[model samples]
Target: MTKLTKRDFIAGATATGAAICMPAIARAQAIVLRWADGQAMNHPSPQSAVKAGLEIKEKTGGRIDIQTFPAGQLGSSRDMVESVASGALTMVTEGAALLGQFVPQISIIEAPYIWRDPAHMTRALKSPLMDELNKVLGEKRGMRVIGVTYYGIRHLTSGSRAINSVEDMKGFKLRVPEVDTFRAMAEAWGAKPTPLNFSELYLALSQGAVDGQENPLPTIQSAKLAEVQKYLVLTGHIITPRLVIVNDAAWSKLTEADRAIVRSAIETASAWQDAEIVSQENSLADTLGKAGMTVLKPDLESFRKPVLATLPAKFESKWGKGLWDRIQGL
Candidate 1:
């Protein structure tokens, strides 16, 4: 080896110093986004966000880093969305019902019996119609919805009596979210709708404060509702979808290529989450049955007729006339 001169030695030292500092510079320049959600860490949606965050970092070559906060770590779902809109938070996964307060038409996604099934729901949400709604949401609230994931279909659970028909719902005190659609759904079935905080539901059910409640099977399992509720009636009343929303300003800051990478990562994660939710929903009935709940597949048509007849008329004005039919056509 040739002996190095002072100039050569200085040059070598400068290159070594630059290489050592490169990673620290990249870390400092990386765009870190906080993605928050209300679901527990074990829940599919939150897990999906975690998966997307990893993929985003990998695909963006560490230029973008997503940090996920699950189970209301940041705040309640509504609060998180508000934070996103105000730019306090970078992103949030929220239900259409909560986002509906921004665009009333969007809330119809949670209307009872509107979607024929999950496939239909997925198609409608991905369709051009939703693009129009998304535009409206962005314009009205400065929030942009980038991805949608399947949250399980909502069903009824009873502590005392199995809901076999609409008649069976008469005088039934059903716990429902304070949302008007849910309250209207319970009333259409002839049940007395009790608006209560979801945090209080388990104790309420255990003590007979409410006769029945409705939620997706995965939620039922995750919340350990099988312990408090004795009967699972497959009314399949509502199909809920979670929206991956970001502040428009935050989304606009990314380069187009980075935006594409982030979107692709989220799409991949959502597909994985959808499959997991469907798998869990398919098995949950038996799982809950084994846990001492009687699982009943009630005549869904009986449940469907009343909801369609009453709900569409009640909601179509706000959701846009024919929006219900358009979604059903999906």
Candidate 2:
């Protein structure tokens, strides 16, 4: 007949616990996971990744603790990948294009126009082919892919002129990701591709080592490239997705419950990241324009032809016809 208030319930519960139980409970549940990335903490991708980690801790009742290191404080992407492989670091969120070096199958996703839309890409990710690719990485390469997050539609920024067509790219010295697919894409577009570390891109642009670079508008804005670059072309050449990866050694050490928790958390986080990128893409050009950069709307069809023409041959050779067909079917 007695009604218990919330405070009464807590007091009653605490009264049943031994004095030593609380500390033991805390000690048994505390888990610390380290996450490293090559972007600033405030950057959307890293921020989203950290938000996911925090959500995991909250949902798990503080049983999981995540320590985030951003802005290359831990190391470069290559170093982070190596650290994750060796179990020196717990996890990292990096561009899938970078994974092409370790798993060539990843290069197929880097091919231009691989997906007609973000929804298409998301669906393709859930396909059995993608599952097989992830399995291979975990079973053979010592890395476990948790989920994929979008970077956004990539565009061209330059110090010289507006890129209106493939012909406009001629003589442009463009900084590209240190990946063969990107290099090949830039070459196909008629630009001279220069491979540079993302960290070195700012200086490369400032010193005129490269006349331009391609990236999402948010990246161009976040890195303050507008201050040095004069033109912005909406090429949407590639829509890059970043992979959430953990070292197989680290992942294998976790209990199945913990692994499931980690996987679920990554999926939730990737969704948040993808939505954030879409929102950013919607507003990025306006923001860049306000920053004094000349924004040009180019004839995307002309650019698409060259990129698509090169894809079939390049992807078929690298990933084979079956996998490429499977992706196309998606």
Candidate 3:
């Protein structure tokens, strides 16, 4: 990753194309795909996406080409999701929690303390329940999930103050991504959920537009949020996930051989990304602590109990009755 050469990703696989990964994607016959994400260029999400793009190129013999846009170059997460939905963009990286907007059942996984650990997330998502949910979204919203990548256990960061209890979060404005599940999760703990785009989070925190925000450590590090935030509370509230998706139109356009190539490459890239994130999370706290942030591992049960209690009444209607129990059984 440190020494990326032109032939590795920029040069198009088997075709004698220019030394640009996205160069001349408008060729008459090649299926050019746009892979967009809101994470920073240095983040593992984009890095893994680049690797997947190269693999797709190689496996498809240059028949499929992918170009990546990082750091909200396309737009906010909601905007990118819509773009992909409308076929304005071929693909985009989005969180499953946000996908709840279209397919509400998937949001059940995003509820607080749902995944016992990162591994549980992998198993639960790859389980039949998720398969059925994916099928629903595919039939209803044209969403074709290519990969499920691990985002680390989420924690809280604030410019001032430490959250030691649910009482401490009372009335505190927490900046959440433009996703409803987070808003409900934050509200369940009695925090004021302030929705903001991730791309604008650092500035929002630095300028006091929001009191605090929650995200995985790799994101906090890659965004240099330590410069703005002071306290890192390891509540480990939610083990989040990001979905790499292509529109159904794009999927239908692909031949069976091309679809297989893309799916295999995506699975390979997702495994690498998930492993890398686990390694990063293992040590990111110390790195953020060294950056002058106070890191505290509060009593997680205090945070977990309140949020978990709300699911049956809050989400059961949409996610279906006993969905949480079924997920846990998985």
Candidate 4:
């Protein structure tokens, strides 16, 4: 055989060293946590999640690794929940409105006028009531809620025209998430609620599949919904909260040390995301105006009255009056 060149020898040595070092590196490294969200990678929620992951690795001295998949690369919010529940996926960031499907008691957050401001909502979340609810979710649903981040204040956007009152929404085809609370709200507003997958919403709007939809300003801006829609009604009917969750199975598998690192990282991310959402909401009116969309500040109380009148009785009977009272106290 020909003599081995110096380059070949060096390459062979490097390969051998890498092979020997890999197991040690892994042993010292943090367990890799996989997370997926429905928003685009650059969106604030996912961006915050990514930053939090980096912080976790740094804080833990590379003892844990976090990998985030954005833009529904895995699937929609519902699919994410199922995957996480089955331990097929590690974690997901989802909206409370969507999570209502699995745990109906959590839907109380989506009630119209439930919170006067973001601070009120934050306080309510930390209450014993919510802590008990978390236990129910963990014990019954097999998921752990790490933390919650605000999405934004919900608003109505339409292709037809401005919605100034309850009457304006009559007979309108409004797109809603596949959740009962949202559908109920749409029906109470006199609009025909059409459940559509979020991925299909843009095309549906552009093709006239639906006349209107509702979401916060950042989502409207990030998704470029203003480009396809004409009128925006600022009703602020709901203050949306995004829940960060992990599969109970996956969470249980982690060492207690690793769990502590994950929790701390998530708390940091929650604070960052909430502040960012507030700033974005404050600036969104100007942003939407520049995008050439007409923004209407509708009579929010008038819109809320109808939904509030009926929802309490309906939900209290199903869940419990005590739960409703606890939420009201908050």
lDDT agreement with native, every candidate: 0.84, 0.79, 0.84, 0.81
lDDT of 1 at 73: 62
Comparing candidate 3 with candidate 4, which one achieves the higher TM-score? Answer: 3
TM values, all candidates = 0.86, 0.87, 0.90, 0.89
lDDT of 1 at 53: 90
The parts of candidate 2 lying over 4 Å away from their true place are: 1-29
Per-residue lDDT of candidate 4, residues 163-258 (tens digit): 899889999999988888788888889899999988789999999999989988888888899889999888898888888889997799888887
How should the candidates be ordered by lDDT, best one leading?
1, 3, 4, 2
Candidate number with the higher TM-score (1 or 2): 2
Best by TM-score: 3
lDDT of 2 by residue, 1-330 (tens): 123333553464355334436676555646667787776655787887778888888878887877777776565678778778876677888887788788878767766778788778878877786788888778767997887888888999989777888898987898998888888888888889999878788889999999999988778877889989989899888877778888887678778988888788878877887787788889989888898889999998988898778866876766776776778787
Give the per-residue lDDT of model 1 (tens digit) for 266-317.
Answer: 9999999999999999898999999999999888888888877888899878
Off by over 4 Å in 3: 1-27
lDDT of 4 at 24: 73
